[model samples]
Target: MNNIEKIIEIKDLKMTYGDKEVLKGINLDIYKGNIIGYIGSNGAGKSTTIKILLGLVKGYSGSVSIFGKDIENENNDYKQKIGYVPEIAKVYESLTAKEYLTFVGQIYGLSYEKCDDKARKLMRVLGIDYAYDSRLSSFSKGMKQKVVIISALLHNPDILFLDEPLSGLDANSLLLIKEILYKLKQEGKTIFYSSHIMEVVEKLSDRIILLNEGEIVADGNFEEIKDSSFDGSLEEIFNQLTGFKKHNDLSSEFVSILKEV
Candidate 1:
């Protein structure tokens, strides 16, 4: 609504790598307390746009503003209100879960004692407190993902950026996480969720933005997107919008090749 605060603004955004263009003139506005599902296939500029928004990537041409402040300006204070869980969990394998979480919390301006206490409590809540003292190297993919999620929320950020956040989570954890995101939105926190799982996106997102090639092909709610294309589910709409209708053909060809002598 017009009364709600605008948390993120991007205008004429564009990025390139050498001769290849990644993002081509993206313009979008996101409001607080919204769960925005940003979906795209491989090389569709999804990650690139997220990176630029997070200040992790450079050489992008556009005007990006977060929390009403221009990110291009000299001030980096806006980042303090942002939390990000990258597509890959990059942890210090040598460090224990407690140690790593404590370190991350401290980076967010938390005191050592406070960070340690908070990390322990969070790990307990996530049912991973038993492995608190264990090195990250000993943790499974799902465990590591939980740790990353905790670290991102350690500061209780106003905005959360998640890429493939539920990648290796179990069914129970996945359901819990979805509930947690809903609670966070109720608290007026903005969530920018990027994933290839159309079902989850369809269920969780207040709005969906689908990108293709280097541009956005669709942006709306599930019903609106469906109405824009043929009547179908989100996955079918995605396939239609992306111009991909060859799943059976591709699978048959793949199996035929495997059958070859």
Candidate 2:
């Protein structure tokens, strides 16, 4: 992204909870139009880093800036330019799909008519408009996830953060979402995509950032890293960096334990 303005900057970020340190020290600079794949194993500070960027967790050491302004100083208005679909979407199951999206739009200061129009179009495109008036509690896991996607995109944000956005999506829906992500990048919107699925990240991300134990272990594209770390897939590379080598015998070990008992 030559000549593109920097959209995010994080330096020496650190966080702690009680006696445990979550994020040791993180440093990164993300530019406009970047499809950044942020990946790490469980408890690697991936969630903590994202929470801090979203301004959910304060009292962190180090500096973070988004849109050239210190994140700590940003107000609610700043959040308007960003859309976030969390890993676990906590929605009001009692509300109909339409009502839930409408409420979300209202929170972003959108008019009722505008929200309705956008919601209708998005739901239709995602092939879930038939469930529009249905209560979320009655929907399957995949259906509810579609609603969450529509709500996040209703405002046409400048930057999008998707944490495991494909968690419960079906094959068709997953393909559609992948295509949508490509389109978003084409439109010059910066995106932070976080997930444990290595294949998805490898194919979509322009650059990949690996985090381990609260620190960045690798930062590069798939090909850039494939040369040294692993000659093949992102999953292989991840295993290498994360020291997950024992998986080859896990099934055998389980079988042995079962037989013994």
Candidate 3:
């Protein structure tokens, strides 16, 4: 592991929001070309961690290094090698897909002609080229998601931070995106995939890190994690590790309550 290229490193990472401790001493190292499934329940600090790593959050206590440089050093060069898709689609509603994507590509230092050409080609490949000239406000959830994905990759980043990227995609789009991610991994791109979809995470990740109560409780490959927890599936292991095994009982109780009405 030491000989491999370490792309991201977190040491004793801690963050507090008002009185709530969001991250409680997280220590992790991400190597190049690895797809990491960073899963956790809501408010378990998964997004917070990613935000900090992306330099969007501040006042965190600990050290974070990207590309062998400390993030706190105020060096913005590392950001050029990274791309991020937020949990929410926050595209400019009034701008056409071409306009928005072209602006994004330009921000990454691409020429206007290059950005426009690449954007058009990518939109065409995704089957959304017909709407490229239309306002983003008219795009469906899936279309907007596809645009965001394209914008993030326009810079050819070495690392990708995707937070719930498959939120509103259809089956075919989802399958294609999964294939794209796999191909990206083959090309030595590190992917930090944060999602609640256990099945996708289980199948896609080279390594999985499970967070519960602001701490990593499980970290390993699928088979290793299963063996360690003595569980059958990733979902079962997630339930066991997160200490949430009452789905059946909870459902039954809810049903009984409904019957009373």
Candidate 4:
């Protein structure tokens, strides 16, 4: 993977909202066809970086380039090759599943005929075969998630950004999605995956980039991450790097509190 070309690059990225600085001098590169697990706790600047990458948040001081083209010069034309599934399902609740997907496809400059065909096939595979005409407000969390996933994939983008994409999926859906992502990788698609599910990241990620306090804390594969001779899962490595201490005494402390009551 080291020999692979970088599809996205960020240099000296910094963003400040109001008085609070969110991203502080960040630098990173995303290679083509790499499944990068972007791990971070709440307020660790993960979302901020993604927003900047997708051209949502603006006025940040730094350089961001995609396909070696400066974003300032390229904007939407450059963004067309990217697909994003946000952490929240924020689609129009009044629209039916089919209608919502049509809207998304249109936003990506896809035709209604193309969207209908793609949406039906994707929904069938994602286990929403029967909900195409149903209102989005009547759908469950998992159902809505399926729709969001289909929307992002409707355009067959080169770069896919998934932020907690498996938020409301069931076991079957989770397995199916993992398989689908694996297939996408085989097809040479780059994926930026963000989630708190350490187990999933450990299993699927070709490389893990851990973010802490608006900076890159650790960036490498599992072996490279455990190069310090620590033998454990990504969760253990994460805890060690993030200054997490053993909570062996916390259980007893809580028990004592319960006893006091």
Candidate 5:
């Protein structure tokens, strides 16, 4: 693909934490307007890779470019075009939900009226309108997650980076968020989402990148990956590719101990 058409490009990226290597010579190219799912087991370097791309982690050995701007040299400009939602939702405890969103909009250089209008619309769509004026410290986990999502989208960024976007969400809210993702994709926004939910990833992703122990084990569309691998669903394919075995050793050991008790 042409360089100009690509939204994110990583080349020979490497990151190490003390004695442990988190990412090892990873390369990826993400085009514009595509919803890409990043799937991996815990400590597989998915978050590390994303942090590098977002300029949150530094001192890595590689080249990363977002929208043709080098991350190392032009992070500020690139950051303005991207929105990020972390795995854990964090908001100002004393501030109301509307106040938090207003602050975020101001950081993005949006007018108060525009921010209020957009925040109300997003809160309504995400089913958090009733709690918009409540202090975030009193909100439930799912409610806080909705506020984070709304804040991330307040600026209508061209690229969105979401880490575990569905965490602490109800089934209805999950569906609503899924619909929002689809709508964003339709509007030609690039989304890079990380999650362990294989079923949801299979349904929503245009492409999937599987990582294992800081290395890429598989990368392709769901159909292509399945066709090239053993017969099964995405979960099965993932288990097979990542060498995950569902042994009952722990369960068996616990049951044996219970017999003695």
Candidate 6:
């Protein structure tokens, strides 16, 4: 496909904090309607990449384009076409569920009636309909997460960037969120999600990108990585490709010593 057809394009992306480089010449492209999974260990710069795409951080030395516009130059128009759900769900504690989402929709330039209708539908799907009028401070972790998801979709953006979107969700909510993601993909919405959960990535992603120490280590489908002898399961392949050794081996030795006691 041509470059302009891609929903998200990153070329030679680089970022640094002091003398430590966080992103090292990263290059990636995500097309419309595809779910791309970004997997990496802690401090691997996954979140940094997402932030740069969302224009949350600037002064990077690469080019990033979303929906056919340069993120730097596009301004609000580009931002309005994308939705973001951060790893931590932050909401106004004093506002009710409906109230909070209404506020978010307004910021996206939606009318009050449209926002209310969309918010109500999303809340129902997220199993938070009963809490529509409840204050955010009175909601559970999962409830808060649902609110965040609802807010992200209220504007009906073409691209959704989710960072650890299922971090604090319960099992039911997790399944619900996954289903919702698949539905969105069916509707031709591009989704870029990051997480440490290998199984979920394997199941949900059309393609996976492995990052290690601010570098793209592996980028391909599961079968391709396995055929290259990376390993069988996604977890095994990730560890092998990223050169991550399990610290649990040390714990095993300690447990053996305790057994002798």
What number of clashing residue pairs does each candidate have, in the order they appear? 0, 0, 0, 0, 0, 0
Q: State the TM-score for model 1.
A: 0.98
Superposition TM-score, candidate 6 onto the true structure: 0.94
So what's the TM-score on candidate 5? 0.94
Expressed as tens digits, the lDDT of each residue in 1-261 for candidate 6 is 563257888999999999999999999988888888888998899998988887789889989987767878875678887899998878999999889999999999999999999898878877779889889999888788888988998999999999889977999889988998999999989999888888999999988889999999888878876787666799988888777676579789888999994
Q: What lDDT is obtained when candidate 3 is compared to the true structure? A: 0.94
The stretch of ten residues in a row with the least summed lDDT in candidate 4 is 240-249
Residue 170 miss distance in model 6 (angstroms): 2.5
TM for every model, in the order presented, reads: 0.98, 0.96, 0.98, 0.94, 0.94, 0.94
Tens-digit lDDT track for model 1 on 146-239?
Answer: 9999999999999999999998999999999999999999999999999999999999999999999889999988888878756778888888
Better of 1 and 2 by lDDT: 1
Q: For candidate 2, lDDT tens digit of each residue in 41-83?
A: 9999988988888889998999999899998877757688889
Error of 3 at 102 (Å): 0.5
Single out the weakest 10-residue window by summed lDDT for candidate 2. 224-233
Please give the lDDT score for candidate 5. 0.89
The residue-by-residue lDDT of candidate 3 on 139-257, one tens digit each, is 99999999999999998999999999999999999999999999999999999999988999999999999999899999989999988746677888888888898999999999999
Model 3 residue 129 CA deviation (Å) reads: 0.8
Cα displacement (Å) at residue 193, model 1: 0.5
lDDT of 5 at 191: 95
RMSD of model 4, in Å?
Answer: 1.7
